[model samples]
Target: MVTTAGSAPTPGTILHLREQGFRVVATDIDPAAPGLYLADRGHLVPRGDSEAFLPRMRALCESEGAVAIVPLVDEELLPVGELDGDGLSVMLPRPGFVASCLDKYVLMRELSAAGIGIPRTWSASDPPPADVVADDASGGFVVKPRSGRGSRGVQLVGALAEVPAAVAASGYRADELIVQERVTGPEFTVSVVVWRDGGVQAVVPKEVLLKRGVTKYAVTRHHAEVERTCRAVQSALRADGPFNVQLCLDAEGRPRVFEINPRFSSTAALTVAAGVDEVAGLLRQAVTDGPRLTDTWREGVTMVRRWTDEFISEEEFASHGLAPAPTVPLVARGDDPAPRPRSTDPASGVAVRAR
Candidate 1:
């Protein structure tokens, strides 16, 4: 399987694919993405929005004889989805499903209409009645672009009056934003792996302990109610491949979904380290019709986040197919020269045995 972005989960993905005896090719626009060094081959590509991006990716796939592409970033998801796969598969949900997930308004409306508990969200261009916003303000309201990703443009507002300023600075039209009740409490992330046929193969919920926009600490903890809720949401969405369901528990410990990523999440490696290797599971289904992997992660496994440094000389850096990393970010702490065999261990935690 081919993976792109060459950072975080992409490196973990390359490691996993490598273990399965697949020659993994990693790509990124930035040479300093850090994940490039871990691949069988790496290439510096143009930005996703560049006109040359698509043609270059096509050429890469053709030259590498890549069977499927496992995209690692949301910005490239739709474009990658649109790639003419020929006979190769792009391990992603349908275009409509992806659109629904990316547009939080659509996802919330569809799910809430289906009786799922979702944050009360409304379009900024067409907000709710005055009294409704007043009522929601008691629970803390949030404003963000309608199609925003993660916490990029999210803004917390004390009252509806403050929304206009946030909307103005967002670089999007007022109507292009989404305002909703802030569902705050204890947050959790659910990593789900679905069969190629869109069957729910596995669900592992990790209680989020710390985060700064993205998850920094996630601990594996199984909550039956959240699992049931996620299962229901998954069935309603009919999403395939790997995706994450992020929610915040109510005072009574019930889940209310605030976000859904129709692609693999940044914390995916943490999910694998905690016990469920969603990447491996997807690869198995994508490459072969294999028996599914059941939930078998050790409970209470918590991952701590921090910056790490890897040192490489000019030759080592150029040999792996990436430009030199800037010197300032090095933090001055790593020196090693070891030539090892291709490892698919992922280096996350335990090696998941392919069933």
Candidate 2:
């Protein structure tokens, strides 16, 4: 089972899991999520933060006979992590680690204390002393929500003086945000898969070429420093599941970690494409003893985001109790616009035009 089917990267992840011969049960708050229709089955559930979300998810797993869960969104991680027990297997880092990762300030403090390379960070309310601010005028500071993922509420300012206005414009309380010296250089999103006994399974470092909230264009690359920094993070956090490290290299080629996403990022598919199927391997380990992973993975594999359309006939749409699309025929019933190959799934009676 995977939650947040509506996310951009989920449908491809679902298809990849299915290709691995797993019966995927996708769930989302919205019924129209494309992954829902592509999965073996799907269910609509309450929002991840709602009190009712866990109960519905528990019941849905039992009803669907799902043995494991992979939460794709941050909001659902804590609640879903609690579901890990003898009966159901949940893929998440330890509760403490997850908690720390969710709060940027706490995460940086802890990692910094552990001697990991971290940007100069402080709670928004406790602004850094004027002398401590980097003298490089071109190198700005970042003001972001203390407990959120991605660049949604992050703001960049040329100096500490602009932080006040940025926070005020962001509509977040001073204490609810964090200020950090912005690190610059080549950025990489590294995936570190750890085993139950804290063994580092595989570290795949991807050089990010483009990003919009999530990575849109990335290529698998081998950077010893980046991989070394990620392993150091695993050693510090001791996360027993998969987590992604977002970092940047300074002028000296040292990796400075900026954020840690406790769950698989949208780039999980890219990891799979590069050769290590982290999701499938983790699921195997969670259910039973799994194989050991090696450090060798093909590099230079790239992933580019593209738009894909999934078409559903009016009849199949109505079967799910949803409003049907316009009844007008795409072309006149007997008129053949062009020759196109068509396929049908007998079980669901959904026909598709393949191009």
Candidate 3:
């Protein structure tokens, strides 16, 4: 297995994979990235240099006898797809399938062509006719870069007069921008793992918690609605591999497909916690016959951001040939007393302190 940025959130998926008994070789362009410290073997190469990076990855797979390559980052997906692993399998959908999922315009066209309900959309250059825009009951509309991800360059414009400036400032050519009728309702994410044989292996759905400025966050599981939308999206995409389909529950309580991510998404961690292990499924599909789809997800499970701080003691630091002096005091006199140090139990690495 290969992953980039080996940090929290993203690395959470890789760590889950490791717990499933798969040996992981983590690679990133930054050798000193914190995630490297967690992997069996961590490698670094020049940044944005996939051309030079591919050969090294091929060598690592050959040496380690790796069965598949799973990309955690978006940029790595296409390049890894292009690599000829020389029969060493890379666990991704067909190249065309991956591309179709990645390209928003293509995904929309395909979903629409398949009779899936989606927001009314058009190219920014050819803004909908004034009469049509006016006649639509949906008031505000969203304009965004057709190929962008992470909600980058996305705006909700309430009027047609706001579109030209929004498009101009979006850093996309007129043709690359798409204007869509903004669907008003709760947003949900449906994560589906598909096999090459056109089967839906697992479907996990999550409800999003949106704040003012932060990109939307998946905070809870909504099983009934999630299941409904997941089935709808799976049938629509005809997905072939691991993909994420996002949808909004429109005012009428109907799901409308919004965007599709071709690679693993941030929500993978939540699905794993919900007992739908996508990484394990990907590996299983790559190595053996695909596993039968099941509804094993645990609902009402919640995951919140957690922060852990570690303090290296003087003796421990010296044992590793580091300076013994403290860089920062562990406790200050007037400050709240520090808690007792907990045992460094390797299992889960979550320390338990006595009262």
Candidate 4:
């Protein structure tokens, strides 16, 4: 049995695991979590601060005869690592490795030292020596939080003078921030699933088509640079579990490491759609007792954001005495037919809008 904690298990992942013939138990601190509704057995626990939660989790695991614990959220990763599983395995990297990857600055430094190509970066707290900053900033620069995720505290600033405010808004002292010389290029994400026995199961590369406030909105598979970069970073990090590495292709099309996520990423859904079952890989690694590597690639897959409406119906609007759907006037008129009101009904279903 595999147990998941924190956020509810993603439906895609849960369904994939079930198809792979594994029983999964999912838990979250919020009982109303949508993911819980689809789980085999969904339960709630006290929020992150509660000490009693670990015992509850342990009891659940014991009762269910759980063979492994899999943490689905960032907050639960470390805590789950620290929990005594009574010899039951937990599907996660070592605690130290997880911690190192959580901090962007540390991960960058390690990757750079390990001979991985990375952009030149400086800590906001250290601010680089005046001479070093001057040398590296020959181009422009980006200021971001040292440990932030989702581009929450990332800013593209043209001059060093803009650094202080960006760092301040990042919720970190100057020393706890990282300022990197902006590497101009197209960005890509490589999602790979690795097993504990030093094997990479799948590599899916995505070209970032649209970024909405740092979150990827549109993406498609077309480039092999992501695979090369993934291989380099995976070797550099020496990570033994599922992880993602973000890279930027420089002017010459060379990939440079930007950051690393040491767990399943928000973009994992895209890879799954591209025919890489990461959850299945995790389950295989957990239940099997041998070294395994998957070198599969699914190219030419595309994913785009969709929008749709729900609740209000066209009939209901007509019944409410609203104007019928507008029609284009066929003959010349003093004024054009009033435009149809935009759909105000709340959207519920997925809408696959073109990028």
Q: Which candidate would rank higher by lDDT, 1 or 4?
A: 1
| Top-lDDT structure, candidate number | 2
lDDT of 2 by residue, 1-355 (tens): 9888778888888888888888888877654567877787776666677677777787877777888999999889999888888678888888888999999988998899889997778888885856556463357889999987678688999877787888898878989999888888888999898866898989999999998777899999999888988888889888878899999887788899999999887898889888888999888888867786677789999989876877778777555553322232223212223322221211221221111
RMSD of every prediction: 8.3, 8.8, 9.8, 12.4
* Clashes within 3 Å, all models in order: 2, 0, 0, 6
Worst 10 residues of 1 by lDDT: 346-355
Candidate 4: worst-modelled 10 consecutive residues by lDDT: 346-355
TM-score, predicted candidate 4 vs. hidden true structure: 0.75
lDDT-better candidate, 2 vs 3: 2
The residue-by-residue lDDT of candidate 4 on 44-150, one tens digit each, is 44333345556666666776677777665555566667653466666766566788877878988887888777887878887565765556464568888777456
In candidate 3 the C-alpha lDDT for residue 62 amounts to 68
Badly placed stretches (over 4 Å) of model 3 are: 46-50, 84-86, 129-132, 136-139, 211-229, 307-355
Which of the two candidates, 1 or 2, achieves a greater lDDT against the reference? 2
In model 1, the clashing pairs are 19-344, 125-175
Q: Candidate 3, after superposition: displacement of residue 1 in Å? A: 2.1
lDDT for residue 193 in candidate 1, whole number 0-100: 76
- Candidate 1 regions exceeding 4 Å error are 1-6, 129-131, 311-314, 320-355
TM-score, candidate number 2: 0.88
TM-score, model 1 to reference: 0.84
